[model samples]
Target: MSIFKKIKGTFQLLKTIDLDQLAKLNEKIDLSDAIKNLGELDERQLKGLMKMLTTKAKKGQHQLPPIDGDFYNLDLKLSKEDRDIQLQVRNFMEDEVKPLVNDHWNRAKFPFQIIEKFAKLNIAGIAYEGYGCANKSFLLEGIIAQELARVDVSISTFFGVHSGLAMGSIYLCGSEEQKQEWLPAMQRLEKIGAFGLTEPNVGSAVAGGMETTCKRIDGNWILNGQKKWIGNATFADVIIIWARDEDSNQVKGFLVRKENPGFKAEKMEDKMALRIVQNAIITLTNCSVPESDRLQNANSFKDTAKVLQMTRAGVAWQAVGCARGAYEAALKYTKKREQFGRPIASFQLIQNHLVEMVSNLTAMQTLCFRLSELQDQKLLTDEHASLAKVFCSMRTRDVVGRAREVMGGNGILLEYDVARFVADAEAIYSYEGTKEINSLIVGRAITGYSAFVN
Candidate 1:
């Protein structure tokens, strides 16, 4: 009689549920497990399950909007195809990259596993024409940079080296044969690439302090010196090494292969930030390359500056992504974290922090969008790029700092995500162009005085 009464109750509960309710429950739990164990449940257990399922259904129906950093709805401005690509990359980061990031970051290891899968996205050399590239708008390229950095700045820095510095060097300065040999493979991510411009002794003054010398003899160039902080150098298939011509006293670029006997790359250790990026110190001990491998069109520092002008904009976009990621994570944390029996997000001070973060993030996004537009129109200058890099990196530092502040002690934890952004922002702030260097570049343009050492 008792068993019969419980079965009747189960049947009555079933009548109140429909496929929609069951589908929602599937998202919250493994329904198949529930079904397999249903027969073993006592009357009390059956009643408890019914109540839990009903509560989940109510919560499902009231699902909140997804947390996004785009407070200004900038995504709506993208074309349908562009918007689709953005979402695809976002989903890949959220699903594939996000899960592996903290683990890899904690161990200070690069997740080489993602490279093949990331290649399938087909975004490398996206703005350049030919060479298996999409030849999309520069704006799309900036958007891709933003999307990648939002998840992990190390990943962003890795891609920037391969896609922007390495591939862009060949596209802008490589001979017809050089481009044919390298660009297609590089674009497919079949052959990873690195750029070696910053040497141990020459960071801010790489143009004039270039100690790496290349001497031409027997129609082969011999490279002799070292490069520091070269991203992706440890495992790259090729590296674009910039050196000074011994006789001409002019800066030149070389396509140095990893298989060369004299080329060696040692991984940099104990980095405080961007630990997942494989930065290396490269040594060229009489590294020899065929004359054909030289970047034929790279006659002077002016040509190399062309590549920097373009990639500097990408770095600005990356800063915005870093800020956005921190802002979104902090916002989500505050909303769910409770104090005094209510969410901290409802507190007045927490709201103020959130508001400040979003404002800076939105401003940075709009600035970069316009910078990309100028780049696409061929109206961008070195100063334009420098200004954006300066402003965005500075603003990003503020945004990430506040994000850490709002989270309190948990802000520094690696599991929380915001902590990584806070640390990585420091790297972005200094690289490409430091605040002092980039600001002087902009100031020189506006004031018509050369503040830089010549």
Candidate 2:
């Protein structure tokens, strides 16, 4: 409280500021005169003055909020172990996958080099038991899907086709012998798999109007048809092909090897979205498969529906990731982008766009959370999965559109990252189940009426 102590404290505070800042302050006011007046002030006044000056000096040095997109703190709901796994997968995507995505996507090529590293994650078929899988909850599987698509949608699509559609078919419908034969290797990423269901002439209606046919000859089934838009078909070691039986007219599934004499997969080019995924037009000309390779449990369309129902939930999660990546990218861009000599994030209109994007992103995340919970509880119905696919895919389009809008011209450029998300969202909107088709599935459940045309 002595004059000497006050002067000493003032000097100490002055030392905390740099020379440049002191010069700037001197321009605004007389520094020597201010110090003379400060010596005349009471102890309390001097203390207050010192605090004010120190706070002002550190104004722009305050820490900014983290760049996380999980606005609702949903990760707190996960267990420590589950949370660790989530972080591990997130780190893998951000570290290994992100740097290479734009280049691979622009070139319309898959980075086959990363397959070995990706296999180290050991996440494939995580929800299923045995066969060297992790046997974790379906929620973890959904989270993995979200994390994968958060960095690159094409990689997520490739994973979904292999782990969800291909392995799921064998797990749910394959004979125990067949599962024992393929799943362990597939889980280790030693053998990649693909699903062939959508045909050249049929997509949503393939259940009843399938053109692919199989006949039993000399105890071997002969399959003849073409499957279009088959993800990973070009290099998959195995493909789960669905064909109609000539005798019973019921749909059946066969495990067709890529080395089969009559099987062919040609890469489809000129795609606008998910360019990193190797989608192929598969042709089967009397592809012969032994009876032992047939999926014993997949007897009708209902069996195939089971696989679709499961993967549809995964697709919904993918949409959430796509939207999340775009939102985060745009948010970061806004905070750093300046216009009129100030950050655009400081403007009212930019904040509004950011708020809207996060709102939709949060809603989609919560919805998918509950959807995965239902799957974990074994209560997920086709309608539940379909409704989620419809809602999330629709909302994803809105979130990505706003993301692109906020970035203006830069949003269209691939280097900005939002542009890739914008293009990929269109593919998510149409695939897995179109909005109209999924809505009808939900409508049928609610109204107790089948509106689907035969």
The TM-score between candidate 1 and the true structure equals: 0.87
Q: Looking at model 2, report the run of 10 residues with the lowest lDDT sum.
A: 41-50
Residue 182, model 1: Cα distance from true site in angstroms: 0.7
What are the Cα lDDT values of the candidates?
Answer: 0.90, 0.91
Total backbone collisions for each predicted model: 0, 0
Q: Candidate 2 residues 1-454, lDDT tens each?
A: 3444656878897888898999999999999998888766643355556566555545566444656788997887888678767877877887788999999999999999999999998999999999999889888888889989998899999999999999999999999999999999999999999999988887757877999999999999999989999999999999999999999999999999999889999999999999999999999998999999899999999999999998999999999999999999998999899999888988899899999999999999999999999999999999999999999999999999999999999999999999999999999998888999999999999999999987
Candidate 2, superposed: residue stretches over 4 Å from native: 1-62
lDDT of 2: 0.91
lDDT of 1 by residue, 1-454 (tens): 1433555666677668899997898999897786667765543345455556445555435434446688787877888688767766776787789999999998989999999999999999999999899999999999999999999999999999999999999999999999999999999999999999988877847777789999999999999999999999999999999999999999999999999979999999999899999999999999999999999999899999999998999999999999999998999999899999988988999999989999999999999999999999999999999999999999999999999999999999999999999999999999997999999999999999989777
Which structure among the candidates has the greatest lDDT? 2
Query: Model 1 off-target regions past 4 Å?
Result: 1-66
